[model samples]
Target: MNASTALLAAAEGGIIGDGRTGANLALGAGALGMAIGWLALARAGGGISTGNVRTGGMAAIAVGTVCTVLAVLHLATASGGPGTGNGLVGAIVAVPLGLGAVLLGRRALTRCRRADRPADRMTV
Candidate 1:
């Protein structure tokens, strides 16, 4: 299939079993993005020193955006409410998780930029 169609199918859980699959996938992605963002923020703040904080922040932002989009798509396409096995609750929860990730990533990015500037330079 084409790119758009394939993405829609993937977001819809691959045309397979129940609707929960998409929600679960979105939840997992959001959690992963949040974790990455947290680690990046820590690294930027000097709490960790093993990786590049800027790269981690960018990755977190991208993944978080994707997670939010997937969750929204699932919510839009879901057929039932909270108790009908449609994963409405999971999608609802994922929204904040994804936004949290984005916020953390942005914080880390700002820290990275602040650290990169040369505060001691003369403005001649």
Candidate 2:
């Protein structure tokens, strides 16, 4: 698959694998889902303005990062609480989603930059 396709797939996989509705898991899952939706739309062929897609993807990345960090912090604190097991679950899910978001964001940025380059100068 192409880079865009691969990125979108990874993002979607992360989103689907994320389990929502449990302490930090909820936030992390939501963030991952948003990222997947945005990036997937961005990669789709001729469905929307590239600028809008880029903006949405960037926003998702930012939100996902914040959510991941917050989830991690929650997990760390819950180590002393009864919800430690839930926290562990969140951590397990969040790490992969967070890493995927970062990678997808980088890929989207790279694609945007490449798209902006003068077509005539593009090498085959």
Candidate 3:
């Protein structure tokens, strides 16, 4: 299982030693780590197939895109002005995560297509 899924399962099982707060922290960290992991995989030219790595990368991209958009909306609605650090940090992190996911997905799709192609036959 991926980091996010494993963390979520652990949270559901109450496996975190620090209770709900710890579970929340674990989930958050797992999500971020998953995103980073996917990006690294993509950059490293891994997960070119329709495998777990590719699926994870796509999921990461979706989550990252959503997170980035939500962060932007939150920042826009914040009356405390643009100096709020949380929104800024979220924006900075999410965009790259989303872009990396998209890239990995594209790479996987391309590889899958290439693998499915039939080899040329001899005319003799």
Listed per model in order, the count of residue pairs whose N, CA or C atoms clash below 3 Å is 0, 0, 0
Better of 1 and 3 by TM-score: 1
**Candidate 1: regions farther than 4 A off:** 121-124
Candidate 3 at 23: error in angstroms?
A: 18
Model 1's TM-score against the true structure: 0.91
RMSDs, each prediction? 2.6, 11.8, 9.2
Query: Which candidate ranks first by lDDT, i.e. highest?
Result: 1
Ranking by TM-score: 1, 2, 3
Angstrom error of the Cα, residue 84, model 2: value is 4.7
lDDT of 3 by residue, 24-108 (tens): 3333543564555455465435444334544554565555454444333433432333344323444334445445545655554
Clashing pairs in 3: none
Model 1 per-residue lDDT tens digits across residues 34-57: 999999999999999899999999
lDDT of 2 by residue, 74-98 (tens): 4553434445343456555666676
Each prediction's TM-score against the native? 0.91, 0.58, 0.44
